[model samples]
Target: MEKTDVEILFEQIDNITETVQQYSNETYLDSLAVTLEVIFYQHPPEGMDEKLQEQLQNFIPQLDVSKYKTTEIRKALQLAMLKGMKGATQQQHLMTPETVALFVGYLAGKVTAGKKNLRMFDPASGTGNLVMAVLDQLETAGSVFASEVDPTLINLAVLNANLQKKEIEYFHQDSLRPFLLDPVDLVISDLPVGYYPDDIRANDFELKADEGHSYSHHLFIEQSMKYTTPGGYLIFVIPEFLFDSDQSDKLHAYLQENAHIVGVLQLPETAFKSEKNRKSILILQKKGPNTTAFNQPLLVQVPSFKETKAMDDILAQMNAWFAENMNS
Candidate 1:
């Protein structure tokens, strides 16, 4: 009996995984990992009925899976299977498609209003969802840079970019490390909170087990400002608790001293219900020394969006704010 194409592909994937595992360090692992993920997602191996399998065999070339690692290929296959098993029930809590639409709309409004030449960065880019959103709204001239610590999640993000046929630079790095290069025009990140898989030591004074080890929304905001050019923007998704915490006071003080609090959008709980987290979008402007005379912060409290109408209301307000503030 002859081996099926699926079996052959699985064998090829295994070979790639073994090759990647041969490398002791992370660099090779990261490179092969992302490539493997892209291949797996592009031609998932699981849950394909005989008809679907035959269709895929014709559509997907056998040579395409040669460049990636087997582990990454397997992981992608597993993810697809898991998602299928959970089905529609898993999607209910996910951020509504409209939420992403509103976000892109707001981003478009900003870009149209002289936020051009935009150099965007997301420090904690997860599966490249927000990064993709920004790219979809901006022009081809714009550049996006993203960093993710989790190798598996980073692979997913790279795959997402490949699926979109977009060019983005992604780094596999711990966000807490000091960036060696200069800042970009904009920094947008959805900060990780509570317990996360990739928590790193906050600083030399902190231990990895310390509560401070987790990436803080305040830290991302503050550190990101350092990388942002004066008059540039830092847009981030943060936990609501950040607004009222002692850390918030410190973050506010830092912003008062270094940047302008441009706006805050209180996202619906549904926005992050899938992740079981509460989130808010904050838009901040890095101020130049000459522009630092403003005495206070601009506080805008946006209501939660429960449906399309609510999202429309939010988009309108965000568009209005961009029109009033951003110059074309």
Candidate 2:
């Protein structure tokens, strides 16, 4: 097949990024920011100047800024920047895989697509891929909101959304607090796991005080639910160990009593292999005053889906679970 404009632009941008990466300097981030600016925007943003343009010349030899539109440039820049994050040792941001991102987003869209109105939020929306996926399917799904603490990643997310002319109600602060004034219909995230700083949590999270001090993931789950509307859906791509820990017992109990946790699908170990964590997708439907007596969630052990039969079994397990709970 002949290469399309997107394919050709991405390849050219890739070559430029590879050259830029070889320059081992403390000013790497600044260089990258300027590189993106000169390529994407005709005017340097506010304080930046033509000197920033000099930085680009060394990396991209045959600069044809006129060849691509601003939107196309932004797309290539976003792709290059994210690729750099995955490869860099220092300041690396581990993004969720595209398949997983699309899966969760598609599932949410499938449920809420035809609804008259709906809102979706992601607590830790790295690169905005998850929200973008949701928008891809549920094109009519109302507004999108997300929070990211890291300055760089948040900026990338904003740019990615804007490139496609999608508006996001973005908050640059931590998503742990009561960020949204109004509760949303759906919450979707790949929650970040690590030790949350104690002094930070010394405020309102007295409920999970101890458990949160150990792992911030617990706090994210509890806080994420707080932002959701009653009977709203909460979807997370999180570690399997999130439920296994003794500290998480309270969370498990609270979810069971308060939400109809319809599915707990153990993702194949191959999903996203990091040295420390195996992941799972938890699908939750918070109960309202009118919700019926809670239903038991389907819990299934998935296999390594190397071939046809294993993949079939995994799908079968999830389909059976969805049949019972997607309505509740």
Candidate 3:
């Protein structure tokens, strides 16, 4: 008997779970675990065949399904497929569906009261997943512009945009370099980490202690502020080390003095495969002279997932919090 699409998906999930379980240390397993969880949580694709199902099932015995939420498992599987399709090496760090969903929900909350036709920008849009997520939540009048340093990633992002039927203006360039600054209502970026492609250059003035000197994140934050409108928001996924490091102190201080630090979401180590334990999302809004003050940072520390219910509960909590603090 032929298996159903849902059955194939389930088998795929099982295979991925097995793969994750095979590794003694949780960190050694592929980051696909998060992708699999996201897939199950969101829309499950249809029409998978038995052959594909069997191939996916091959990896099930390696994962520890008990350690992840259902949504996370689905996301992990989806991410693994995406990586496979892209021919990415084992070292590549692909964004999971859960990350995208979380970002989308945050963007949705950030612009709830803004103009109907918002302008959005992503400085380092890899595969366009983050931009697509933002586009999904914006109004029909919203427009998106994105830049990817890698030509291959640009091609993939273009394909993704086409698949989603989203209207986006994409550029192949290093976003960190100086360029024609366009005014925007929102800027959402996931800055690169560790080693980047050869074409990317560090700013001349910004110096790194271990790495070579480049323009600091302070420069990036300043540049972002320059292009954003007074009431616009800037959401960034930064390395956790930078978030609280001394180098980041000035940026945080600047944000506190000039902008409103709306929220800070500390992601799990599993959020990005490359950095291990240092990654977080900083949500900032450019404040005008009249901007009101909030009591404390809307900080959320998401726990490691081991079940679908946990993921759903986390999402619900985040959504409720956003709704409650819409103005902040």
Give the whole-model CA lDDT for all candidates, comma-separated. Answer: 0.57, 0.67, 0.59
lDDT tens readout by residue for model 3, 1-328: 9964434555665455444434323332232333243233332223534454454455445434455443443343445446444545522245534564556445554555556777888877766777766665565437778887766567556654543456889878766666575788888876665443332354332232234443345556666776788877888877677655555665556677778887777776665545564567778878976666556767887665555677778778876766677745
- Rank by TM-score (best first): 2, 1, 3
List TM-score per model, in order. Answer: 0.65, 0.80, 0.64
Over 4 Å off, model 3: 1-81, 84-93, 96-101, 194-212, 215-218, 270-278, 305-320
The residue pairs in collision within model 2 are none
Model 3 — TM-score against the truth?
0.64
lDDT winner between 2 and 3, please give it.
2
* Residue 125, candidate 1: alpha-carbon lDDT: 75
lDDT of 2 at 270: 73
**At residue 125, what lDDT does model 2 achieve?**
83
TM-score of model 2 (CA atoms):
0.80
Model 3 alpha-carbon miss at residue 44, Å: 30
Q: How should the candidates be ordered by lDDT, best one leading?
A: 2, 3, 1
